[model samples]
Target: MRQTWRWFGPKDLTSIDDITQAGAEGVVSALHHVPNGVVWTKEEIAKRHSEISTRKDGSASGLTWDVVESLPVTEDMKKQKGDWREHIANYKISMRNLADSGIETICYNFMPVLDWTRTDLRWQVAHGGSCMRFDIADFAAFDIHILKRPGAPADFTNAIADEAGRRFEAMSEDDKKQLARNVTMGLPGSTESMSLEDVQAHLNEYGAISRDQLRQHFIHFLEEVVPTAEDLGLRLCCHPDDPPFALLGLPRIMSTAEDYKYILDAVDSPANGMTFCTGSLGARPDNDLPAIVEQFAEKIHFLHLRNVKRDNDDIMGSFYEAEHLGGDTDMVAVIAAVIKEERRRKAAGRKDWQIPMRPDHGQDILDDLGRRAQPGYPTIGRMKGLAELRGVFTALEHGAFGLK
Candidate 1:
């Protein structure tokens, strides 16, 4: 795997020096300044690339902006409501501009309501700082109590509702605000935040669209976009739905392996691929991580490797900063599967054999708390994660080559 670090462009507090120091060879970023539904011009892409390339040696040696963490889909695109054809056309133009500049891998998600939900952005880790995580109870608390969207209580049982109510009532004002920010504030790589009115308006657009409707819309999107991607030699990797479940009255389409199969089957093109995110899929215990990797080995273009600790029954737990080998994911087996796929690609003489992989989310530690870095993208924590993954990959490669 070719290791990459996600840099949120020039506005990010963590400079290119910080990324290089973290031992990443490539940068995953997007033109965050550009609004959703607008075409990203070639000049905009070049400007951002040149800005990042301005390092101490007047060159970004190990840094190449090869992956876009996201090019957000407007609400119109998701709902397939009004002017979406125009939006999709603009998105295709952006992909073409990005590809013209040598970006081959593009990662995007089609989740309806939220991109990724976290009850706490500063959820404290026992040893030091914090990492982002979704607490089911906390989310329930928000749905049924804080935001208090109608019909929210029905989503949970009486016992769960009661617990959520209690948690909501007991929370301090600051805590409530934090939870709101955690949920409503769109993270970097995604678009801007929405007012309550904006969210309600967005929901109104999707009122007629069920999960099936959304799925059809996504399939239609792929049908239109994938051919353009293929022409540009860009692999369009769709990120799995985070939390892998429906929430806040929105539909989730890409939650399971079957969902992925449906997507590829809809487009039936190599350009339509998956960005295999372990933490996202691992949230649902039913998903056998290794099995999915082995099954979809041919279509996986990118990976976000992280682990989550799921408790028994319905009780969910915090995300631990587990070592690459220590997490719930059978990473050794996962790596072995990836290696098998790489070997297969090599035998076929494919150029993009070494997939670009990143340590997904990291625990916020050390000086990261005070720093102005993007949320959940702390410098030291990700540096540690990248280092650990690299060590694991090295050992696996050596073992494959029979190196003592």
Candidate 2:
């Protein structure tokens, strides 16, 4: 795996110095300042790269910008209606520009309403500090107690509803505000944000759409854009739905193996593929991690390796740090499978054999408090994650490939 770290760009508090010091040799970033549905010019891409390269800690030594965490899908594209043709065209142009600037992999997702869901951004970890996790109870609290979207209480069992109500009643005003911000406050690449009123209005817009309809929209969007990506020599990797399920009446696609099969068959293109986030898919026990890795290895261009602890049939939690050999994920089998795929590509003489992998989310530990960067992206946590993953990969390579 070619180790990479996601950076929010020049304005991000995690500077180039921080990233290099943490030992990431590549940056997974995007032109976040650029609005959705707009073309990203070569000059803008060049300028961003130049700024990153010229930082005080200096250039990305053995590093380069090779993957874009996302390029926002415009509302028109997601709805598969209105002036989406223009938006798709702009997306293609942006891909072309990114390709010209040496980016080969682009990570995106088709989840409607929310990009990723987390009940707590600072969920306390057993070791120390905190990390992100999704609690079903918290989500229930938000739906039936906080946001109070219509018919939400029915989505839960009577017992769950009762528990959620109790939890909601116990929360202070500050607790409610934090829960609201954690759920609706858009992250770095996400262009949309919601006030309570805005969240309601957004939900209202999806009233007529069903899960199947949303899937169709995603397929239509991919059919329009994947060919352009192939032409531009860019691999489009769609991230799985975080938590891997529907929430707050919002439809979810890309939550299962069948979803990936449907998507690849819908477009029938290698350029259209999966990012294979373990933490997302691992939230569901039904997903066989090693099997999925082996099955989709050919189509996977990017990987996010993290683990979650499943409490029960739909109730799960994640470890804050990406422990190379800890948590529920079988790190040995996962890394072995990735190496097998890389060997296959090497035998075929492919240049881009090393898959780009990142420690998806990390524990907010050490002296990382009050950092101004994006939440869940604290430096010390990622540094710890990187160190752990490196040790695992080193041992695996030595044992599996007879290389020390």
Candidate 3:
């Protein structure tokens, strides 16, 4: 696996120098200042490339923009309304510009309104460090009581609804506002942030759209852009939903193995692929991570190797970010499956056999607690995770296990 780091452009707390010091070989980033649906001009792409490739001293940083974490799909495009076609054309232009800049792998998501949701940005753990968390009852409180989406109660079981009611009743005004902020905090490196009013308006718009219709819109988008990606020899990977389940009554189409198969088969192109995110999919108790890796080995172009400790046995229950190899998903076996696929591709003489991966998220420990870096993208914590992952990859590749 080729290790990379996610950099949030010039203003990111974690600098490019920090990424290199952490031993990452490449950088994953996007143009957060660019408005959604606006075409990414070649001049802008080059400016980003320049920023990543050089330091303040004008020396080579020895890293290139290896992957685009997101070239965001707009809200209009997801709903297939109001200039969605123009957005599609802009997406194609963005793809071509990125490919011309020599960044071939692109990651994007189709999660409506919200990119990823968390109930708490810094939920303290037993280790005295903080991590991002998704508490089901807290989320329900925000949905049913705070956002007050009509019929939101019908989405959750009676047990959860009652628990949410209790939680809402017990919360302070500050706690209630914090919960709302956490849920709609918006994408980390995007030019957008959503207020409660913005979220409620989005929910109102999606009320008339069904799961099936929303899915068709995603497939339609792939059909439009995948061909352009293929022509430019680029790989377009879709990030699965954060919790891999429905939330706030919004449709979640890219949450399961079956969901990925449906979209990949619909577009039926080499360019159409999956960004295998273990933490996101691992939140679901039913997902078999290793098996999914093996099954979709050929189609997975990028990897987000992190883990989550599910708070309960329920599929949509609360969960928090765990150490890279410490979560419920068997990290050893998952990496083994990935290596096995790499071996197959290597034997077949595929040039892109070594997949690019990043330590998705890490716990806040040590100085990380005070650094106040991006919620999940801490310096020391991620370096520790990357070191642990590298250890595993090294041992497995050296035939430590009997597989070879």
Best by TM-score: 3
Across 1-404, the per-residue lDDT of candidate 3 in tens digits comes to 99999999998878888888899999999998898999999999999999998876888999989999899999999999899999999999999999999999999999999889889989998989999999999999999999998899998999999999999999999999888888888674743347889888988899899999999999899889988998999999999999899998889999999999999899998899999999999999999999999889999999999999998879888999999998899999999999999989999998789999999989988999998888788899999999999999988888555358
Please rank every candidate by lDDT, starting with the best.
3, 1, 2
lDDT tens digits, residues 269-373, model 1?
A: 889899999888887878889999999998999999877766433523334334445567787678778878988898899898889999877767788888836
Q: After superposition, how far is residue 367 of candidate 3 from its true place, in Å?
A: 1.4
Candidate 3 ranges with C-alpha deviation above 4 Å:
188-193, 399-403
**Candidate topping lDDT:** 3
Model 3 TM-score is 0.98
**Least accurate stretch of 10 residues (summed lDDT) in model 2?**
315-324
**Residue 77 of model 2: what lDDT?**
84
Give the root-mean-square deviation of each candidate in angstroms.
2.1, 2.3, 1.3
Candidate 2 local lDDT, 1-404, one digit each (tens):
99998888877777888787788888888888888789999999998777666657564455578689898787678876677889999998888989898889999887766777777777777776777777777778988888989999888878778888999999999999888888885554552347888778768878778889988989888888888888888899999988787777888778889889888888888798889898888888788889999989889999997777666655333223345456677877888888889888999887778999998777778777656346667788778888888887887788656432
